[model samples]
Target: MFKAVGKYVRAVWYLMTFRIDKASESLRMNPGVVSANYDRIIEEKRGRINQYKDAIAAMIAQEQQKKDKLKEVTAEIEKLEKLKAGAAAKARQVAAKYSGDPTATRNDPEYQKCQTAFSDFSSTLAEKQARATELEADLEGLVENINRHKLQIQTQMRELEKLGEEKHDAVATILSAHEEKQIADLMTGLSQDQTSEELRELRELRQKAAAGARVSRELAGLDTKQAEAEFLEFATNSQANDEFDSLIGLTNNSPETNNDGPESTRIPES
Candidate 1:
């Protein structure tokens, strides 16, 4: 409440003190009616502005969640992209490793080496394709939500613009109701919208900030980690039944093994 009051004083103090005199002088206005009317306007404006600030804060909270989701999805996307690159690199290496020497059937030592590499690359590629598809779908949904929020904010601003001074009169009616039903009349006269104009303005400011937002690009580096992990995971999966003696190198791939700890999970992945 105090913060809202501070903001109100800063936003309208000049108008109330300096500009109001000019308005009264130019119009040869009735000071008494205007002062009474002005009191209501100030209250409504202060209420509305505070409401706007709260709404904007809420929007920002929602946006932060969405961005976190975006980061997760983007991380997955880079992981897949890196997996794609690794799959191709491994494919070339495997073909080269298995090729040049004829008579080396799948049972030959070198042939077995190349065969395992080829299978790992193919499996990693498949996983990459699936994760990339999921990441794209999540990104599309986030974009839709962002657009919906934008439309809502624009509509709110237009409604606020239409409210004008009608709200002030309504507030006056509320505080000054008489035994003759003046309060009831005032409450009836003030529309819900008149009371909410300030809330809308705060939301608009948040929307503007959101619209200018951009995705961070450094997250693209997740590809290398993704590729390496995918290869390790495939090795782990295949070796789960193998006597390869290598222990299927997936220790680095599990969530439990992350530097941030298992409690890192938060927003939905994009």
Candidate 2:
């Protein structure tokens, strides 16, 4: 029931349905319906495309800042750990020096004093080392999290770029069945003038699709010059059509046909 057109189509379905006959006639003769549809699709695609790009940029800027701070925290943890190890080694050296003194009592003021101080220092150093290890682990985890976020952002951006207009058009292919019927009815009852208009719309759509395809290809950085060449070809064709149409209008009020000769051309005759 709801799997044919799109939001835009859904919103305007009534009008389209009401004028179905007229629209159909216009479409058959000019194909302007195709052009209008293309315009809607392209507009939708461009909006989504920009949003995706902005999301990637925002994620990079915001999340990368947090990751940089985590790096600094890791470095600080390492430095503190080295200091703790040095304190432990120095305390052991003093204990060893006093151990060799046979005349010294284990309970003597000096030995006991040194022993008390060293034990306290050792405990403090151990605590610092433990804290540093925990901090290091947390920092490493943070880095991994940031990397995963970065990868996700990049993947989405690439997919969006790749999918482009095709994906967007596909998204909108869910209009009500009634909408299809309405459009069909319109197409069947269209007048010659209306049909010509529809045909014209279709021709314009073909040209835009051709150009948009080129732009998409250029974004992918692949075979771009070919797209440029094709666009140039279409532009030249359209200009020629304009001139031919003017001549036909002056010579005979009737519309000119097949100026481009091949069915491939979009603009009217000449």
Candidate 3:
């Protein structure tokens, strides 16, 4: 019993699914529905593309930031190098003051101050240079990524445009197919369309109406009256023809001149 119940439920589910699918298919095939669906899809794609563009914009912004940072780092490195060179120049002048006294040059407070300054500058410059190198690499990567994304966006835009064209073509093709199907159905005499049925009913009604009119005419003795009129017209035309024949000498006597009968001949003397 449980197995049977399960089977029954399964069958019902399958039937429902089938019906839903069939209905969906029919709805999708409608021209207006098809167009609306395409529009919806296009809108969705456009929204997604906009989101993608936003992301690309962010990357471009990041790329610019990296470039700015790299420029700043390079400038700082140049300044540090200049400061280090200045420190070395100051140390040389101090050492020249001690002409031949090497120990005095090493112990000189001014020379020692210049050496310390140069060492600090050298360390700072090296650090800045390393940072500049890192920024350059990051900027290069960002540029490459930005360029690739731009290409992708261009391709997507083209695809979007093509989708627009496809929408029209799809609608046209479906409309044409519908028209052809209707014609084929009509030709095959298998069309069960409501409009076709209505047209047939209208024609039937028209024929019945004509037949009723004929019946009504017969019932009202109008047909007899028409026959009587025709007979009268025939008699009038025959009389007119006789008169014309007599005037043209085609008949021996006109009804108006020989109403009595044949005329008698007169006899002479002898």
Best by lDDT: 3
Candidate 1 wrongly placed segments (more than 4 Å): 1-103, 169-270
Off by over 4 Å in 3: 234-270
Overall local distance difference test of candidate 2: 0.63
Q: Estimate each model's TM-score.
A: 0.32, 0.34, 0.83
Measured with C-alpha atoms, the lDDT of residue 140 in candidate 1 is 68
Query: Whose lDDT is higher: candidate 2's or candidate 3's?
Result: 3
lDDT of 3: 0.92
Instruction: Choose 1 or 3, whichever is better by TM-score.
Output: 3
lDDT of 1 by residue, 92-191 (tens): 5555666744553434664465556556655765775576566567656756766676676667666555554555555455445432354455568654
Backbone clashes in model 3, listed as residue pairs: none
Clashes of each: 5, 34, 0
> Looking at model 3, which ten-residue stretch has the lowest summed lDDT?
259-268
Clashing pairs in 1: 48-198, 51-199, 52-198, 52-199, 177-183
In terms of lDDT, the poorest run of 10 residues in model 1 is 250-259
